[model samples]
Target: MTTTHEISADCKACGSCVEICPNRILQKDAAGKVFFRPDRLWMCFRCGQCMSICPSRAVMIPGLSYETDFYPQPALDERAFDAFETLAANRRAGRSFQDRPVPRELLEKLVEVIALAPPSFPPVKTELTVVADPALMHRSLGLMIDLYDNLVKKMANPVARFFIRRQAGRETFITLNNHVIPLLKERLPDLKSGKEDTLTRRAPAMILFHSDRQSENYRTDIAIAMTYAILAAPALGLAGTIIDLIPPAVEKSPALRALFQIPAGSEVVGAVILGFPKRRFLRGIRRPLKSVTWL
Candidate 1:
């Protein structure tokens, strides 16, 4: 499937589509009717702005339907900003979860939000896998713990450390050495002894966001989708947290590959565990970025 747009005779000559096109491929003729430039056709990334803003529904993009894709947008209340601020301010990393599994309906709602996430490109290249079964999640958690334990052990060897650093790059090796290794070393005994779970936090459900390794901007695409899911969770009566360890572990483990049905040459870019939160915070914490500069 490739991108193509068609303008119908019903075009109202409003000039809205021409102005809205990102690539400026849509133009106005001397008659003020909107037409696509043939030479500039290659620049059209199919963002659908023209079709979306057309009042007469005259603009059509392949794989999209005016009737189905466009809906009556509801007006936001004056308090909408307050509501959004409250939602954003209250979001916290949910590390502990209740024993029960997250409802399928709620998970589907998160998926819907994920669907709305803007792709880095016109067609979304990312994929999501929901592990909703409690037993399956538990098994996956065990595998991840095992994988990290092995990683800690492997990083302890000079030869292994040297090879890993060379292969994974300096920044990646620094992250593993300074952050991941210490955290795993401290948690591995407890993790194996069933004392506590610092990994998935025993959440009853998890979603893996992944894509083909060769896909352009797949990492950012998956990150955006995962962010949408986590942000949408509290509204659906669920808690969510992004787990950084899962993706790397998934990439390395043949067992995890089979479990998640991750195809060859694809990468798991992000993962998040979701469930009813084990506890609630009385107050939200303030976390500002280290630096901000205005140009």
Candidate 2:
């Protein structure tokens, strides 16, 4: 456990550290020196809010487990809000993509911005890895398809289906029979022709977000971070969609995890496939909410 964070000699005693501490662990003594209750160290969120809000760069938090070198900028004005709203309205889930690859620098910039995804709990950090190589992307998708194909094959056996249905429940059969198999069969001709990988959308790039799954808020953190990344994509001249299929497959198979080079104890919670869209949308569509409440 990192026990001590520093307050430098340059401290202006502005009390920002005391005010912004999420855990309320920092305090100012009668001498106006910032100090902390050592017993409350366990509650520190390590959010670096104190260091950020300080007018003097004196509160040096070396004891925190995360990054603190970042500086905030003013990005939320009316014009910025309107621009974001337009971006949100125009956002599309780009199923089909152009053949061109995303530039490395641009993709890196998107990853940097999306790294701002918030941690819902103490220390669950979401990591983003971009699979920008077309060859590697196709091979990885092929490996996932192989897993599904093997599953589809095994489920074809009466004995295997009997055991699987008993062990995994009826939804496995329902998903395979109704959804998975039909879609695969429908794309058979396309698969044979090598015209496309209908499943992956064969996007020029893929982003995989991996995180520890022990916490109850794990999935929520993943969702929030992924949502932020998705909303931020259109502005970066890219398009993406939330991929629900691959994560389940990865969760079920260690081989799939190894194929993507995910960390040993971590799991893939969010996957986004990004690329330039092949076609442009003429207008934004609407989806009205069903219900609301006021008290």
Q: Return the top candidate by lDDT.
A: 1
TM-score of each: 0.95, 0.85
CA deviation > 4 Å runs, candidate 2: 1-3, 30-33, 64-68, 122-124, 165-196, 213-216, 251-256
Candidate 1 residue spans exceeding 4 A from truth? 1-4, 292-295
TM-score between candidate 2 and the true structure: 0.85
State the lDDT of candidate 1 residue by residue for 1-295, as single tens digits: 2246678889998999888988889899897878889899888777878887899988877778877776666689999999888888777889888899888988888898899999988788988899999999888878988888888888989998899899999999999999999988888899999899888888999999989988899898888898888888888778889989889999999999899998888999899989999898889888899999999
Alpha-carbon lDDT, every model: 0.87, 0.77
Q: In model 2, which range of ten residues has the least summed lDDT?
A: 62-71
- Candidate 1 versus the native: TM-score? 0.95
